[model samples]
Target: MATEGIEAVFLTTHNWGKAAKFFQALGYELDFETDHNSGQLRNGDGPYVFISEIPEDQETQTQIVLKVPDADAFRADSPVEVVTPFEDTHYGTKEMTVRDPDGRLWNLQAPGKN
Candidate 1:
Protein backbone atom coordinates (compact mmCIF):
# COMPACT_ATOMS: atom_id res chain seq x y z
CA MET A 1 0.00 0.00 0.00
CA ALA A 2 1.20 3.48 -0.78
CA THR A 3 1.73 5.86 2.09
CA GLU A 4 -0.32 9.06 2.39
CA GLY A 5 2.88 11.04 2.86
CA ILE A 6 4.44 12.51 5.98
CA GLU A 7 2.05 13.01 8.86
CA ALA A 8 4.43 14.49 11.40
CA VAL A 9 8.02 14.71 12.51
CA PHE A 10 9.01 13.27 15.87
CA LEU A 11 11.90 15.01 17.56
CA THR A 12 13.73 14.39 20.80
CA THR A 13 15.55 17.09 22.72
CA HIS A 14 17.59 17.35 25.86
CA ASN A 15 15.86 20.55 26.92
CA TRP A 16 12.14 20.74 26.27
CA GLY A 17 11.79 24.41 27.14
CA LYS A 18 14.65 25.51 24.94
CA ALA A 19 13.65 23.30 22.06
CA ALA A 20 10.03 24.49 22.23
CA LYS A 21 11.14 28.10 22.33
CA PHE A 22 13.41 27.49 19.35
CA PHE A 23 10.58 26.10 17.31
CA GLN A 24 8.31 28.93 18.41
CA ALA A 25 10.93 31.41 17.24
CA LEU A 26 10.90 29.59 13.90
CA GLY A 27 7.14 30.43 13.70
CA TYR A 28 5.75 27.10 14.82
CA GLU A 29 2.96 27.47 17.33
CA LEU A 30 2.36 25.07 20.15
CA ASP A 31 -0.76 23.03 19.50
CA PHE A 32 -0.88 21.16 22.79
CA GLU A 33 1.41 19.93 25.53
CA THR A 34 1.32 16.68 27.41
CA ASP A 35 1.80 16.22 31.16
CA HIS A 36 5.25 14.98 30.31
CA ASN A 37 7.71 17.33 28.63
CA SER A 38 6.34 16.84 25.17
CA GLY A 39 4.15 18.76 22.75
CA GLN A 40 2.98 19.22 19.17
CA LEU A 41 3.68 22.29 17.11
CA ARG A 42 2.61 23.43 13.67
CA ASN A 43 3.41 25.99 11.01
CA GLY A 44 0.86 26.68 8.31
CA ASP A 45 -0.87 23.63 6.85
CA GLY A 46 2.21 21.46 6.71
CA PRO A 47 2.90 18.37 8.77
CA TYR A 48 3.00 19.00 12.51
CA VAL A 49 6.07 18.55 14.72
CA PHE A 50 5.96 16.43 17.86
CA ILE A 51 8.80 17.05 20.29
CA SER A 52 9.65 15.19 23.45
CA GLU A 53 12.28 15.72 26.12
CA ILE A 54 15.00 13.12 26.67
CA PRO A 55 17.73 12.66 29.20
CA GLU A 56 20.86 14.74 28.62
CA ASP A 57 22.93 11.58 28.35
CA GLN A 58 20.85 10.28 25.48
CA GLU A 59 21.37 11.58 21.98
CA THR A 60 18.47 13.52 20.52
CA GLN A 61 17.16 12.32 17.17
CA THR A 62 14.46 12.98 14.61
CA GLN A 63 12.21 10.49 12.90
CA ILE A 64 9.68 11.00 10.15
CA VAL A 65 6.13 9.76 10.66
CA LEU A 66 4.38 8.53 7.53
CA LYS A 67 0.61 8.40 7.31
CA VAL A 68 -1.18 5.23 6.38
CA PRO A 69 -4.93 5.01 6.01
CA ASP A 70 -4.97 1.55 7.56
CA ALA A 71 -2.17 -0.06 9.48
CA ASP A 72 -3.50 -3.59 8.99
CA ALA A 73 -3.69 -3.15 5.24
CA PHE A 74 -0.27 -1.58 5.09
CA ARG A 75 1.24 -4.36 7.12
CA ALA A 76 -0.11 -6.93 4.70
CA ASP A 77 1.12 -5.14 1.60
CA SER A 78 4.13 -3.10 2.64
CA PRO A 79 7.40 -3.70 0.80
CA VAL A 80 9.75 -2.44 3.50
CA GLU A 81 10.93 -4.41 6.48
CA VAL A 82 8.53 -4.06 9.37
CA VAL A 83 10.58 -3.66 12.52
CA THR A 84 7.56 -3.72 14.76
CA PRO A 85 3.88 -4.51 14.32
CA PHE A 86 1.20 -1.90 14.66
CA GLU A 87 0.14 -1.10 18.20
CA ASP A 88 -2.29 1.39 19.74
CA THR A 89 -0.62 4.50 21.09
CA HIS A 90 -1.60 6.38 24.23
CA TYR A 91 -2.00 9.52 22.11
CA GLY A 92 -4.71 7.76 20.09
CA THR A 93 -3.45 6.09 16.90
CA LYS A 94 -2.12 2.84 15.59
CA GLU A 95 1.62 2.97 14.98
CA MET A 96 4.13 0.63 13.39
CA THR A 97 7.86 0.94 13.00
CA VAL A 98 9.71 0.14 9.81
CA ARG A 99 13.36 0.05 8.88
CA ASP A 100 14.64 1.58 5.67
CA PRO A 101 17.43 0.29 3.46
CA ASP A 102 19.82 2.59 5.31
CA GLY A 103 18.76 1.08 8.62
CA ARG A 104 16.96 4.21 9.78
CA LEU A 105 13.71 3.67 11.62
CA TRP A 106 10.50 5.29 10.37
CA ASN A 107 7.09 5.39 12.01
CA LEU A 108 3.81 4.71 10.26
CA GLN A 109 0.70 6.19 11.82
CA ALA A 110 -2.90 5.37 11.02
CA PRO A 111 -6.22 6.38 12.49
CA GLY A 112 -7.45 4.19 15.32
CA LYS A 113 -10.08 1.61 14.54
CA ASN A 114 -13.60 2.72 15.33
Candidate 2:
Protein backbone atom coordinates (compact mmCIF):
# COMPACT_ATOMS: atom_id res chain seq x y z
CA MET A 1 0.00 0.00 0.00
CA ALA A 2 1.24 3.48 -0.79
CA THR A 3 1.46 6.12 1.92
CA GLU A 4 -0.66 9.25 1.68
CA GLY A 5 2.37 11.39 2.42
CA ILE A 6 3.47 13.24 5.56
CA GLU A 7 0.69 13.85 8.02
CA ALA A 8 2.63 15.66 10.71
CA VAL A 9 5.98 16.22 12.32
CA PHE A 10 6.65 15.07 15.86
CA LEU A 11 9.23 17.04 17.76
CA THR A 12 10.75 16.57 21.20
CA THR A 13 12.04 19.50 23.19
CA HIS A 14 13.63 20.00 26.57
CA ASN A 15 11.76 23.28 27.08
CA TRP A 16 8.17 23.38 25.99
CA GLY A 17 7.70 27.12 26.43
CA LYS A 18 10.77 27.99 24.41
CA ALA A 19 9.99 25.54 21.71
CA ALA A 20 6.44 26.82 21.40
CA LYS A 21 7.56 30.41 21.21
CA PHE A 22 10.14 29.51 18.59
CA PHE A 23 7.55 27.89 16.39
CA GLN A 24 5.18 30.77 16.92
CA ALA A 25 7.88 33.16 15.81
CA LEU A 26 8.17 31.06 12.69
CA GLY A 27 4.49 31.84 11.93
CA TYR A 28 2.95 28.64 13.24
CA GLU A 29 -0.22 28.97 15.24
CA LEU A 30 -1.13 26.79 18.18
CA ASP A 31 -3.84 24.27 17.41
CA PHE A 32 -4.22 22.73 20.85
CA GLU A 33 -2.24 22.14 24.00
CA THR A 34 -2.27 19.50 26.71
CA ASP A 35 -1.55 20.00 30.38
CA HIS A 36 1.39 17.64 30.14
CA ASN A 37 3.48 20.16 28.17
CA SER A 38 2.66 19.20 24.62
CA GLY A 39 0.78 20.82 21.76
CA GLN A 40 0.05 20.90 18.03
CA LEU A 41 0.82 23.79 15.74
CA ARG A 42 0.22 24.54 12.11
CA ASN A 43 1.20 26.91 9.34
CA GLY A 44 -1.30 27.40 6.54
CA ASP A 45 -2.47 24.13 4.97
CA GLY A 46 0.69 22.17 5.43
CA PRO A 47 1.16 19.24 7.77
CA TYR A 48 0.77 20.12 11.44
CA VAL A 49 3.56 19.88 13.97
CA PHE A 50 3.22 18.12 17.31
CA ILE A 51 5.72 19.04 19.99
CA SER A 52 6.23 17.25 23.30
CA GLU A 53 8.42 18.13 26.22
CA ILE A 54 10.97 15.62 27.39
CA PRO A 55 13.36 15.52 30.32
CA GLU A 56 16.43 17.72 29.93
CA ASP A 57 18.68 14.70 30.33
CA GLN A 58 17.19 13.03 27.29
CA GLU A 59 18.22 13.96 23.79
CA THR A 60 15.56 15.66 21.73
CA GLN A 61 14.50 14.15 18.41
CA THR A 62 12.23 14.95 15.49
CA GLN A 63 10.17 12.40 13.61
CA ILE A 64 8.17 12.63 10.42
CA VAL A 65 4.74 11.00 10.48
CA LEU A 66 3.56 9.25 7.34
CA LYS A 67 -0.16 9.06 6.72
CA VAL A 68 -1.70 5.73 5.88
CA PRO A 69 -5.33 5.23 5.01
CA ASP A 70 -5.43 1.81 6.63
CA ALA A 71 -2.83 0.23 8.84
CA ASP A 72 -3.91 -3.35 8.37
CA ALA A 73 -3.88 -3.08 4.61
CA PHE A 74 -0.48 -1.41 4.62
CA ARG A 75 0.93 -4.02 6.96
CA ALA A 76 -0.27 -6.80 4.74
CA ASP A 77 0.93 -5.32 1.43
CA SER A 78 3.85 -2.97 2.05
CA PRO A 79 7.45 -4.07 1.94
CA VAL A 80 8.55 -1.67 4.65
CA GLU A 81 10.22 -3.30 7.66
CA VAL A 82 7.81 -2.96 10.55
CA VAL A 83 9.47 -2.29 13.84
CA THR A 84 6.26 -2.26 15.84
CA PRO A 85 2.72 -3.22 14.99
CA PHE A 86 -0.06 -0.67 14.82
CA GLU A 87 -1.51 0.33 18.17
CA ASP A 88 -4.14 2.80 19.24
CA THR A 89 -2.68 6.05 20.52
CA HIS A 90 -3.90 8.25 23.34
CA TYR A 91 -4.51 10.99 20.78
CA GLY A 92 -6.91 8.74 18.89
CA THR A 93 -4.96 7.27 16.00
CA LYS A 94 -3.50 3.94 15.08
CA GLU A 95 0.27 4.15 14.81
CA MET A 96 3.03 1.82 13.73
CA THR A 97 6.78 2.15 13.57
CA VAL A 98 8.97 1.13 10.66
CA ARG A 99 12.69 1.16 10.04
CA ASP A 100 14.38 2.41 6.90
CA PRO A 101 17.49 1.00 5.27
CA ASP A 102 19.57 3.51 7.23
CA GLY A 103 18.03 2.28 10.48
CA ARG A 104 16.01 5.46 10.99
CA LEU A 105 12.69 4.91 12.69
CA TRP A 106 9.62 6.29 10.94
CA ASN A 107 6.08 6.47 12.26
CA LEU A 108 2.99 5.66 10.21
CA GLN A 109 -0.39 7.00 11.38
CA ALA A 110 -3.88 6.01 10.35
CA PRO A 111 -7.31 6.91 11.60
CA GLY A 112 -8.46 4.82 14.53
CA LYS A 113 -11.08 2.19 13.87
CA ASN A 114 -14.59 3.15 14.76
The models' CA-based lDDT, in order, is 0.91, 0.93
**Tens digit per residue, CA lDDT, model 1, 1-114:** 678999999999998889999999999999999888999999999999999999989999998999999877864655789898999998789998889999999899999987
lDDT of residue 100 for candidate 2: 95
How many clashing pairs does model 1 include? 0
What is the Cα root-mean-square deviation between model 1 and the actual structure?
A: 1.3
Q: What are the per-residue Cα lDDT tens digits for candidate 2 across 3-49?
A: 89999999999989999999999999999999999999999999999
Best by lDDT: 2
Residue 81 C-alpha lDDT in model 1: 94
Candidate 2 TM-score versus the reference: 0.94
Candidate 2 ranges beyond 4 A from true positions: 75-77
The TM-score of candidate 1 is: 0.92
